[model samples]
Target: MDAGAPSEGWPLDDRGVAYGDGLFETVLVRDGAPRLWEYHLARLARGCRVLGIPMPAEHELERPLAQAGEGVMVLKLIVTRGSGGRGYAPPAAPAPRLRWQLSPLVPDAARWKVGVRVRHCRLRLGLQPALAGLKHLNRLENVLARGEWSEADIAEGLLCDGEERLVEATCMNLFWQRGGRLETPRLDRCGVAGTLRAVLLERLPIAEVDAAPGVLAVAEAVWLGNSVQGLWPVARLDGAGGEALQRWTIGAVHRRLQAVAHEPLGYPTRLDD
Candidate 1:
C-alpha cells in the first residue's frame, strides 16, 4: 500500500456505496504502529456481528497497517458487504471488501491547549438502538449537523436526539464535569461509541447518563473527544443563532484527564505548550 495510493479497486455496485452497508474505523498510527489496535478491532467485530457482515481476518488488516510507515498518520479502514443483488437485498453468500487508506494526521494542538468554542446544532439525531454505537457508513445526519456552522472559531457542534436529550458532537463523543463528577451522554439510543470513549470508561470513574442540553449550563467543564484527535476542552458553547449559552476556563480536571490519556494514548502532556 503506497502512501500515494492507499485504496484497492472499488467496484461500482458495491453495497457500501449503494446502500451504505459497511463499517469503518479511523486508527491513529504513530511510528509505524497503530494505537488502540485491539479496541478498534473489537468495535469493528461487534459492528460486523450486528450488521451480519462477515469479519475479515486479523492478518488481512495487519498487512496494510504495517505499510503505514513512520511518523504520525491516520489509517482509515472500510469493510463492506461487497457487491450484492440489485436493491436492498443482500447476497446469499457475501464477500466482504476491505478497503484502506493512510493519510497524515492533522495537528490540533491549539484547540487541545487553548480549548474550543462549540455550537448547538438544530439537526437532531434519530433513535435506532439496533445501530446505536456502530461506526456504520450511513452518516448523513452527522454530515448535515457538521455543516450547520462554518465559522472558523467554532470547533464543533453538539447534537441532540428528537426528545432534546444530548447525544454527542457531530464527529466526537461528548463529556463534561459537573460537581466533580464526570459524565458522558448515553449512546445506547444513537451516536457512535468512540474507541477513546471506551478507553476512558475503563480507566476512569466516568458515568454514562441521559441528560438534556440545558445540563451544560451547570457543567464545570465540557469536552469533546475522539480516538484520532484526543480530547479538546470546551471554552465556550453557543446557541443556534450564535448566542452565548455557557462559558468556562480550561481547568485542572481537563489537565488531569489529558495526563491520563497521555500515558496510554500518547496525547501531549503539556497542553499549554
Candidate 2:
C-alpha cells in the first residue's frame, strides 16, 4: 500500500478478503508481456458473474500488462467488491474494485538447477463444488499448506484431500509421468484450475486420473506446473529432511521444459497484437 495508492481502489469489504468473494489471476509475464490473457479474462468474467460483480474491460488490464518490463514479470489482477458495509448481505449494484500489480517472477531456480524439495503438507483440501476450481481470493488452505514446513530448503508442499486424494501442490498443479502417459488429477471437486494446467490439457496428450498420494510413489517422474513456476522437478520428496542437490539429475525434465518454454499459448506477445 503505497502513499500514492488510492484507498478506495484497494476496497475493504466483509465479502472480499473475509469471505473470498472475489477472483484473481496471476498472469505469467514473459519478455515484457502476459501469457494467456484470453483464458484469464474468460475465467475472470465468469467468476465476477457468479459473485455478482460487474466485469471490467479486458483491454484496460491487458494494455498495461503488455507494456511491462522484460525477462520474467508477473501481473496479478484482483477484482473485489468496492468497500461494503459490515454484513453478509451483498451490496446492491456494488462497484467492482479492479487492482493490478506488477512484480518480478522468480526465475524458478528449482527447474534450472536440480529439482525442488517437496514434502507432504498436513493441511487437507476440503471439497467445495461451487468454489472448487475457481481461483478465488480465499487462500487460507494454500497459506496453511506452505506454512506446514518453513525450512528454506523446502520449495513446495503437496496437498491432499481428507481422503488422501491428491488435490495439487500448494500453489500449482501436479503432473506425473506414469506408465508412459501423462496423468494429472481431476480438479472437479477441489484445487485451483490453473491457466497453465488448462493449456497443458489442451496442448499435451494428458489424461485426468485419480491422482492420489499413492500416485507419487509409483510414478516414474513428478513435476509441479504453474504459470509462474513453469515446470519444476521433484528431486527429493520425503517427510524427513534429506541432502541438498543429491546425485539424482532432473536434466531430462529441464530439457523438456526448454522445448516448450515459449510454445504454450504461443507466447505472451500474441495477445498484444
Candidate 3:
C-alpha cells in the first residue's frame, strides 16, 4: 500500500462489503506514533479468530501504519476474507484482504469538559453471540441508531439488546458508576468489547454486569469509553422526544477514571497525550 493511497478499493465481490464479513480496529495515533499498538493488534487478532479470517502478521502492516500515522489521527485497519463467491459460502482457501487509513481526529473538547448528553436509541441490537465483541464490519444497527438523533447537543445514542438490556452506545462501551465502583454491560451476548474497556477491566475496579432496562436511572454516574476518545462523562440520558429519564453528576469516580485513562500505557509518552 502507498502512503498517499491507503486502499486500492475493495472488489465488487469482496465479502466484507458484500455480507459485512470482516473485522476492523480503530487505533489512535499521537504525534506520529501509534498508541496502545499491541492491544489493538490483539483485538484485531481475536476478531479474525472469531470470524474465521486469517490474521496478518504485525510486520506486514508496520510500513503502511507508519506512513499513515504520521500525525495525530485515527488509524483504521480492516481485514476481510477477501473477495469470494456469491451466496453465503466463502472460498475454501480465501485470500485475506487488508486495508488501512489514517483520518484526522477532531477532539470533542466541549464534551470532555462539560460532559455529554446521550439519548436512548429506538433501534435495538439483535443478539449474535458469535459476532458480539468482535468490532466486525456488520454495523447497520449502529448506523441506524446514530441516525436516530441529529441534535448537536446529543453526543451519542445508547442502544439496548432485543430484550431491552443495555448493550452500549452507538460507537462506544457503556459504564455506570455507583458507590465508587464501575460497572459495564456484559458483551457476551452483544456489543463491542472496547479496547479501553478491556484496559479498565484489567486495571480498575470495574465489573461486567447485566444492565437492565432502567439500570442507568439509579446509577450515580455514567460514562462512555473507547480507545480514541478515552472516557466521556455522561451528564444526562434521555429517551425519545427528548424526555429526560436519568441524570448523573460528573463525580469523583468520573475524574478518577479520566486519570486512569491518562496513565501511561508503558509507553514513553502518555497514551492520552
Candidate 4:
C-alpha cells in the first residue's frame, strides 16, 4: 500500500501526533525484499527501548512490508505509543500502533555523477545526548533547517550544533575527505545515526569527529548519505553569506566510496574491497 491502512483517521489521542512519541525507519526495498532489514529493525528496537514503547515483533513488520510488491521502493515503518491521555505522562501499558507506507524509488545518480550543491543552514541542532542518534518522531529541528533553503539546486543543507560544530546535513549523515582520510561528524551529542552511515563507518576506515565549519574549507570532497538516496558527492559548499566556501571535483575517493555504496548490505564489507 502507498499509505497506512489504519481503520480510522488519526485519533485525537495518538501520542505520535500529539507529542511526537514514536520511532520510524525508512527502508530500501528491492524486488520485494527489504535491503538491510536487520539493521533497520535493530535501530527501531533501540529507539523503542529509549522511548519506553513496546517494540513490535519482527514478523509483525515483515508481513506488511512484504505487501509492498516488487521493484525498488522506499518502505516506511512507524511505531507509536498509540492513543494517550491529555498530558505529558505516558500510559503505563502502551499499545503501540504500527504503520507502513510505500513510495517510489527515484534515482539521482545522474546529478550525483556531476555532484550537488549544499549550503550552511542558519538553524542549529540542539545538543541532547538522551535523544541523540535515535530516529524518533520529534524532528522539528530538521524541519526548520530544511525550510531555510528553497533552491531546487541545493541538494541539502549542512547543519551545526548550538556550539557551532558541524553535525550533519538536514536529512543525511555527512562525510568529508581530508589528506586522504575520511571523517564524519560524531553523533554522540546529536544527529541521527543513519543506517547507511553505520554501515559505512563499520566497513570503511572512517573517523568520527566533531568537525567545525572551517574543516569544509580544506576538505578534498564532502558527501551526504542516507539509505534512500545513498551517497552524493558535494560539488560546492556555500557559507552563511551564500558565498562558495569550498569546491571539490568528483575524484577517485568519491568513485571508490560510490562503488561500495552500491554493494549489498548483507555483511560488513571489507574496506580493502
Instruction: Give the TM-scores of the predictions, in the order they appear.
Output: 0.96, 0.85, 0.92, 0.93
Candidate 3 lDDT, 1-273, residue by residue in tens: 111246578878889898988888888878667777888888888988877878887876565656654456888887888888979897887788888887898777666656899999999999999888889998999999999989999989999999989999999999887676689999999999888888888898788988785878777888887889877889988996789987776766677777676453322112233
lDDT of each prediction vs. the true structure? 0.88, 0.71, 0.80, 0.83
Residues 83-166, candidate 4: write the lDDT tens digits. 887798988888888887778787675555777899999999999999999999999999998898788989999999999999
Q: Candidate 2's residue-wise lDDT over 1-273, tens digit each?
A: 111122235534435676677788888777775687777887787777777888877656665565576777887777776667677777887766676777886664535446677788878899887778888898999997787777887788888887778888889888877676878888888899888887778787878877668777776677787867666667778652433322234656434643453366343211112
In Å, residue 273's CA in model 1 sits off its true spot by 6.1
Q: What is the C-alpha RMSD of each candidate to the true structure, in Å?
A: 2.3, 5.0, 3.1, 3.5
How does candidate 3 fare on TM-score? 0.92
lDDT of 4 at 134: 97
Question: In what order do the candidates fall by lDDT, top score first?
Answer: 1, 4, 3, 2
Shift of residue 35 alpha carbon in model 4, Å: 1.0
Q: By how many angstroms RMSD does model 1 differ from the true structure?
A: 2.3
Clashing residue pairs found in predicted model 2: none
Model 3 bad stretches (over 4 Å): 1-7, 264-273
Model 1 lDDT tens row, 49-142:
9999889888877667678778889989888999888989888788898888889987688888889999999999999999999999999999
* Model 1 misplaced stretches (Cα beyond 4 Å): 1-5
lDDT of 2 at 30: 76
| Top candidate by lDDT | 1
User: How much RMSD separates candidate 2 from the native structure?
Assistant: 5.0
